[model samples]
Target: MTKPTPLSGFPELLPAQRIAELAVIDHLRRTFELHGFASIETRIVETLDRLAKGGEIDKEIYVLRRLHADDDSSDSGLALHFDLTVPFARYVLENSGRLEFPFRRYQIQKAWRGERPQEGRFREFTQADVDIVARDELGLHYDVEVARVMAEALADLPLPPMTLQTNSRRLIEGFYRGLGVADPHLVISIMDKLDKAAAEVISRRLVDEAGLDDEQALLCLRLAEIRTRDTSFVEQVRALGVEHELLETGLTELAAVIDGCADVSSDRFRVEANLRIARGLDYYTGTVFEIYMEGHESLGSVGGGGRYDA
Candidate 1:
């Protein structure tokens, strides 16, 4: 009898690792509930059009259908959800009248992505997300509060030291619009890959693949490389003659969040200017996040989510 081979990109955790994962899940659930975020579990499948609302997630979806069934004539195009946010959006839209304004909820579940996974990256992974969605608009304070709660939860976990990096979508969108970038989303996507690719590779991809010019790509690279412990990046960016109302607003909002976090302690949180963190999904609108473990920074972000308000 021949031994079976394990799948390439899919990973199976060991007994101890599984136990640790479960413990983490338990901690997250407890923290979320304590923060007044009610738990909600959505259906595993969503329609194609609903999933494709933002276009960023189209490449990651795993389409599904019944096996050995003769339903070829049917127009069913169900897909496994790539993240918790879209289903939450659909759920909120469907249950809007019955639900209260600023519906706060937390969902922890496995999401499937059909991309080629690398080391420490999986085709299917579990995500624990807590979000506050309002009917019209959620206040900015909620953004800071969400980050604070998430930071606290991660800090309490039995893991290495982590940093919470954040950026505002409204601010980025406003800045890109000011820069006259025809497709800011494309630029954002390219910028998101900065950590994975070299500067030249990312620059070429931005120009060739994203339709940005050489000068624009260099500017984007420069913007993405901006990092600071304080709000010094704001001054540097301003010195570069990059003046945009949205960018300024983003700078102010970032300052407030950094200051609020400083009240807790400066060591656990940082405001990174070069943190070109786009969650690469449709549901996130403002305040994106990416958490990095102390020594496992190259393993990619272990935890990430952001504010999404329509």
Candidate 2:
């Protein structure tokens, strides 16, 4: 008989808010389909083992439990999916025999995560993802294509100007290797916090946790500071004197993506190379992306995705 209590992380949009969101989703759908991306929906729940394949999000996964069910129930190993990309990968594997090579698919669905909710982040939220997957190999050109499609979709919407910040895992990993860092992945995990933490704090963590020497930590910080709208970033990284074949490959690939997206970029949308964007997930390889609205920078990334090994 008490009044209903509102949950903090579960957001409920009002009629007006929902109308606006639907319109945006619709526009995204049209844009995606126009780009030859077919629509698909994945199950909300996946086996914990399969979900854990994504990365270090085991703590944030929402386990599925059934009331009045026995301990031996088949649901014991199930949990709600944290992100669409993980599930999409599973889908591709399960249906690989029927799907075409370099299959482009778009999925807009609710995903659940048990993280603290603040600003743009929520425990339960709807996400739209567009991914292109292949059987044996995937071309790099699809990377540029997807970025342009998303940028065009956002431009037609009534949102503020957007910037798609990009980085390369090959670049980060190779750079760390060149520095003789013992654990490049661990360093990346710590460096990903550059946006949320101060330079001094990250530098200390890099030295303490990632086991980097003082000089190496300083160099890592220097690498993280490089950002550019064009291929100018290439010189900045080379100036640091780190050399590795993977680093060179990443530099060329990332530069191509930025240059390729240049034609579609305008006052509304732009793509830039930001070396500090170490997207926290170990599965991400090659090019990584993070989209941000100009005035809402503090809300964290509005949208983000990255390439993974097939």
Candidate 3:
């Protein structure tokens, strides 16, 4: 008999590791429920079209197919979900009639992404997400509310200290538009690489690819460099000499979330307004977040999410 090769991305925990994982999950489940978030589980697979709504994510999706299936099998269109939000949105649409207003749901499930597996990221991994869906309008307070819940959850965990770095899509877009950039989204896409690429590389991309002049590129870099633990970031951005109604709205909203989370956040789990955290996803309309733990900064964000008003 041949010895089986261990899969690189799919993790198999030993008994002790499994127990530890279960304990962590249980703690998160309890924390979420205590905050009035009901637990729910979504199906593992969604149609490729539905999952492909975010174009960039399509490359990271694992398509589902049956063994020895026909060339044109109907199952070929299905794929394992890359994240919980897309499925949750689909669930809301399908079950809208049965759900109550301002639905608070906490989903803990295994999500699959086909991206290269690295520390803190996996091809198959358990993800815990808390989201509040409303029928019409959702107050900005819910943004702060969800952050508080996650902060408390992480603070209670037995892991290293964590920081919840946050930013606003409106803020980034408004800043770019105020700078008179022809395409704000294009600039955003380039700015999102600040964490991975060096400042010089990003500056070159902004000028060559995004068609930004040297001055505009320099300002964009300045905006991305803003990081603060309090609302003082408002003045920092204002000092840049850009003004837009949406920029003011994003500044106010981002400040509110920072201040709101500050009250509940612990020393172990801190919150900061990090402008470089422009989530690549197009759906996120308002606030965005990226969670990082001490001593594991190189692994990139262990967790993140944002408000999708659409």
Candidate 4:
């Protein structure tokens, strides 16, 4: 008899868990549609160049090739969609004229990643996303409202408490530029790894590898550790002797988001200044968000997204 084979990283949920997951999905879909987001879907395969835009996502992509593609000419390195955002961006660009401005849409689909997956992190998993993209620019208030709605949808889930750690890329970039940092992207990339790497290791790498001085590297590390529920985090960052127009602007927008969601009784939503939440995608140009489980902080972000004004 042939032996049975088990797939690696791909998970199978128990009957009870599947029921719970379905209930969660159904609730989220209804909430999203209620907010006027229409539904859409994109094809599974995308070209290699589009998938490899930022270099970081390349590692996670699961490349595909035709069965008869034996030569380099046929080896285009198409890949399974790693996340919903990239495909959505391509969809918007392709269907620009036919689509309405400030397009609001919801996409729920399975995404594949070549990751060493664990319980929550899987090789193939479902992502339920709701986003609003404008032809020109989206207002900051809209950004806050999306976060508010998402929080409400997940409030009843039987999971650990989660907080939306929000920050603005414009704010961080401005601060870095004002500090005379020549390569802000490089700095942001390094800072994004703070959660995975230790403070000492990060500081050393920034100083020795990225050419930042000890003081600057230390300051960046300290900023990564600073998190809060409101604009209070801004005062803490200011006390560190770092003040810049971009940082202040980010703080102001974050304050508006906190105030807008003030009616939400759950403390699960907060504004954290030290949130070094660079989504690592080149498209996101404004406010970035990260959802963290309260007790399982080390498991990394469970959900995240940001505004892409390009």
Task: Superpose all Cα atoms of candidate 4 onto the true structure and report the RMSD in Å to 1 decimal.
Answer: 3.2
lDDT of 4 by residue, 1-310 (tens): 7996668878778999999889988888888888888889899888888888667567888888778766856568788999898899899999999999888899999899998856667898899988888877688889877887788777767777777778778767766766667787888888887777888888888887778888888777776667776667667777777767887887677667766766763755443534577787467787888888888887878788888765
lDDT of each: 0.77, 0.89, 0.91, 0.79
Colliding pairs, model 4: none
Cα lDDT of model 1 overall?
0.77
At residue 191, what lDDT does model 3 achieve?
A: 89
Judging by TM-score against the true structure, name the best candidate. 3
**Which runs in model 4 stand beyond 4 Å of their true positions?**
1-3, 63-78, 116-120, 265-273
Model number with the top lDDT: 3
Relative to the unseen true structure, what is the C-alpha lDDT of residue 167 in candidate 3, on a scale of 0 to 100?
A: 97
- Write one digit per residue (lDDT tens) for candidate 3, span 23-61: 999999999999999888989999988888757778898
Q: Of the candidates numbered 1 and 2, which has the greater TM-score value?
A: 2
RMSD per candidate (Å) reads 3.8, 2.4, 2.2, 3.2
lDDT of 2 by residue, 14-119 (tens): 9999999999999999999999999999989999888875555788999888887866578788999998987898898899999988899999999999987776
* Candidate 2: clashing pairs of residues: none
Instruction: Give one clash count per candidate, in the order shown.
Output: 1, 0, 0, 0
TM-score of candidate 1 relative to the true fold: 0.80
Off by over 4 Å in 3: 1-3, 66-76, 115-121
Worst 10 residues of 4 by lDDT: 265-274
- Rank order (by lDDT, best first): 3, 2, 4, 1
